[model samples]
Target: MDRDMSVEEHLGELRRRIIWVLATFVIMLALGLWLAKGAFDYLQSIPPAADLPLHAFSPWSGVRVYMQFGFILAAAGTMPVVLYQVWAFFKEGLLEREREATIRYIPLSILLFLVGLAFAYFVVFKMALYFTTTVNRKMMLEETYGITEYFSFMLNILLPVSLLFELPVVIMFLTRLRIVTPRRLQRMRKYAYFALVFIGTVITPPDLISDLIVAIPLIVLYEISVFLSGAVDRKIRASEARGSLAR
Candidate 1:
């Protein structure tokens, strides 16, 4: 039997979900600490450089590493729980049919986010590092760095790419909701190109090559979004037309 949930009940459930999510994050944090070195090494593999002496400001550096590893792992490990909670909350606000339609999309969105982060870590981030390091190689009198700074840079690149990679999911959902049409998105193609180029320039270092590298993938993602949007638009429109006919 279906029963309506009260506001108090919903809040209580949310609190419980938050606790579960936090517990998941803590467990993931411990696991991350155990694998911190491996994670660091994986990130290091991308830069393709000789052993450069890296320092940590003692206790603070140690803390930074622990926190950084925890953040990355927590984001990765708790993503499903996080997405579920988000869906749960938003689903309450949506029509029953819409909620049911959206249930399966969350996991796919999470996968896309991970793919984006991995691409950033392995491809875009590495390329950016290579380009930047080579360009400023002449300025590095000391050939040494801080571990905290290194991790900070890693996070900076990883976070944005992961977020940006959600474009396809966003397009799909907007299409599903009939909020945007493929024709409209297509019409804005020139604007999207400029917007992506501007964003890439802002994120990447001040170099033509770096900006182009970042912008190129973004443009491709936009084009893919356009395709997905068209498909979703057709599906939603067909569903709507069927409903209208039935009425």
Candidate 2:
């Protein structure tokens, strides 16, 4: 009966957190729509895109792109709030020291996400776009890009890179929770590299330069994750040693 009651309480808490995240997302969506026009214009002013002319293939294309931009922006804005809620929901089950350490991850995760987004937008995305456009120009093809297609490509590259940037933090968290260890990560390094390389190939343009540009960062992120996991393991071992000495 007690276990059943605890499960019910956890479910209820989860439902509440979901509701809060949804509400926040909805509110931000409205604000995002209002601001999306300026944001779109600013993005267009950037290189690669700046030289190209974007078109609306259909009457609804503009509206659809606006909504897409709004959705992405709103989701990005609400991510921190949602992450915090998720952390809080599971926090009570953690030890005092663990709770203190893990709580700091909320902000770190958000920062890493933003860094990824920026890197994708400023570097990988730009290079890919430029490469494609240059090829088209060289082939004597007129470049008429649809707004919808343009944004779709951007999101495809941006979202994955941003999420991939969280690898270190996620690995560290799992290490802290004893779900994964540095040794395990080290053992899996070659497989992880293959997976990351595959992901980079999928996300970037089909060219060696683009693939290498994207894959290198992902590989670096994985290495960083391993290093962070090692740090967490050392800390855990030190804590255990202290506790044993005290006893």
Candidate 3:
């Protein structure tokens, strides 16, 4: 498995992994749909949304939102399997220690994703929603919201934050593979902060506080990524030195 693979062999392996991932996704999708109603009810019961009325402009809007929820649930459920498949696909090319280290990231990646979702939902999202609603109240605008639009906005905020939270894990993995190093990340700090600030502004309302709230965590995460990458680099170098000495 460590040796070079022919094109056909590679394709066959890829096909097998794809099949496994797809099968898992399908099962998860079904489970998601079955649980969607309860989950939707719980969401509506949350304090921010408790009194907010959701109108379905069209008859299909409710169904669409239900399906959207299903998709979200399915995606979350399938993420670990997908990550494992990805790691397995590339693992044959890795040294024994590298393989072991990378495999541990799958669960950690999933945990970080959940943390991101919670942060967005509880803190960032609540603040943004309150700000907008308060403005609407001040302007004397009726606060009618479409069910589809509401869910869409929620997903837009939740999904990206969760995915972006994987940055540290991704950087650490790439560091192990030698595709990137701490030195490169350190050199790119200013540019990275600018990019993250832009992303924060794009995702958040035009309020400076909201922008900083999102941007600051991202900057911190990037710094954490740099630190983790440096640690991994040191470990790799130490391991290599040990191997050379033993030889």
How would you order the candidates by TM-score, starting with the best? 3, 2, 1
Error of 1 at 122 (Å): 2.7
lDDT tens readout by residue for model 2, 125-178: 887788788899999998889988998888888888899899988998889879
Q: Candidate 1, residues 1-247: lDDT per residue as tens digits?
A: 0137877887888888889889988988788778877777765554443345568866789678877886788668888888777667667656566677677778778888989888887777677666667766877654456788767776788898888899988887777667888999999999999999998887777789878988999999999999989987776777779889999
TM value for model 2: 0.93
On TM-score, who's better, 1 or 3?
3
Worst 10 residues of 2 by lDDT: 1-10
Alpha-carbon lDDT, every model: 0.79, 0.88, 0.91
Provide the lDDT at 187 for model 2: 97
Q: Any idea what lDDT model 3 has?
A: 0.91
What CA RMSD would you report for each candidate?
A: 3.4, 2.2, 1.2
For model 3, state the Cα shift of residue 1 in Å.
Answer: 6.5
Pairs of residues at least 3 apart in sequence or in different chains that clash in candidate 1: none
TM-score, per-candidate, Cα-based: 0.81, 0.93, 0.96
What ranking of all candidate models by lDDT puts the best one first? 3, 2, 1
* Cα error, candidate 3, residue 12 (Å): 1.3
